[model samples]
Target: MSATTGAVLLYDGDCGFCTKSVAWLDQRNLLGFPARPWQSVPDHELPASPEALMTEVVLTRPGRRPLGGADAIAACVRESPSRLRFAGRLLALPGLRGLARAVYRLVARNRYRLPGSTAACRIERPG
Candidate 1:
């Protein structure tokens, strides 16, 4: 879909944990934007580079540069229902942003070890 329609969250389709995470959010109706696997989105439609997509989740919105990693998560939280908007704001705080990014990176690097994650969750970092 075009960015004009709304935001889209792109994640690694090959990763089991990532897939499950998206599905989990969908089940709760917390995802304000459509969630698509980066693999399925056409290259021309992708807002971020292939290496970036493989490393972290990305969010694209109309007339805005894509947000990746913790920033993307904060944006998603802001877009969710009103009841949860505060958490989004909290995540965006300068103090928490760095912590969030660090945590995101740590989890992303070892997602395969998390519960419900599978062998497919293992990913190689781009040099």
Candidate 2:
């Protein structure tokens, strides 16, 4: 289907870790962004280049700017009904965004090497 109007949590289906993580979160149904593999997203409706797709988890909605990586996750938490909303706000704090991005990069970069990941899950870093 085309990218319809809804909060979609774009993930990498090829990544075992990513798939398992999304599955675990989907089971909980604790947030607004529902996870879907990037493979299902139409290329014309993507938020960024295809390369960036595998490098970050992205949150997208019709007629709105997409949020990526840690920010996307923080947005989900902020929109949640749980106490994690506090942490989500903190992630948007001045000094924390950089830290959060760094941590997200760490995980994204290592995801392929992590347990449950296959070689195809490795994202090629763009220059």
Candidate 3:
């Protein structure tokens, strides 16, 4: 770990499940990357609306490119230990990418239904 420029994780602040997930990542020290609530990221800093962020997990790799949904998760894993990185690479295979994307979609779409999310978790766009 040579202090690589960490990725930025933009997530929904009001979703308890999302918060818990961020906490879990933090606990694992996987959140070396900046973790910003979707609402907090300045409009100019974000390439899209907050509503777009709410629809997916956006991981910005500063000066490079951003990853979203399953790709974001994979990128996070790749930035971790060697074993996890290998796993992430394995998932990038054609067939596996589809499966991973499908899984990510399922979790993302129903995140509000998971334990911890309340009606207050509705997505809000930044002006």
lDDT of each: 0.85, 0.80, 0.72
Q: What is the lDDT of candidate 1?
A: 0.85
Q: Count the backbone clashes (under 3 Å) in each candidate.
A: 0, 0, 0
Per-residue lDDT of candidate 3, residues 3-39 (tens digit): 1244577877778888888888766755436676777
On TM-score, the candidate that comes out on top is 1
Q: Write the per-residue lDDT of candidate 2 for residues 55-81, one digit (tens) a residue.
A: 888988787889999898878777777
Q: Where does candidate 2 have its weakest 10-residue lDDT segment?
A: 24-33
User: Model 3: runs farther than 4 Å from truth?
Assistant: 1-6, 122-127
C-alpha RMSD of candidate 3: 4.6
Better of 2 and 3 by TM-score: 2
Q: Give the lDDT of residue 93 in candidate 2.
A: 94
lDDT of residue 89 for candidate 2: 88
Distance from true position, residue 36, model 2, in Å? 0.5
TM-score of 3: 0.79
Q: Can you give the TM-score per candidate against the true fold?
A: 0.89, 0.85, 0.79
Across residues 53-83, which tens digit of lDDT does each residue of candidate 1 receive? Answer: 9889999898788899889978887888757
Q: Model 1: how far is 83 from its true place, Å?
A: 1.2
Q: Relative to the unseen true structure, what is the C-alpha lDDT of residue 123 in candidate 1, on a scale of 0 to 100?
A: 81
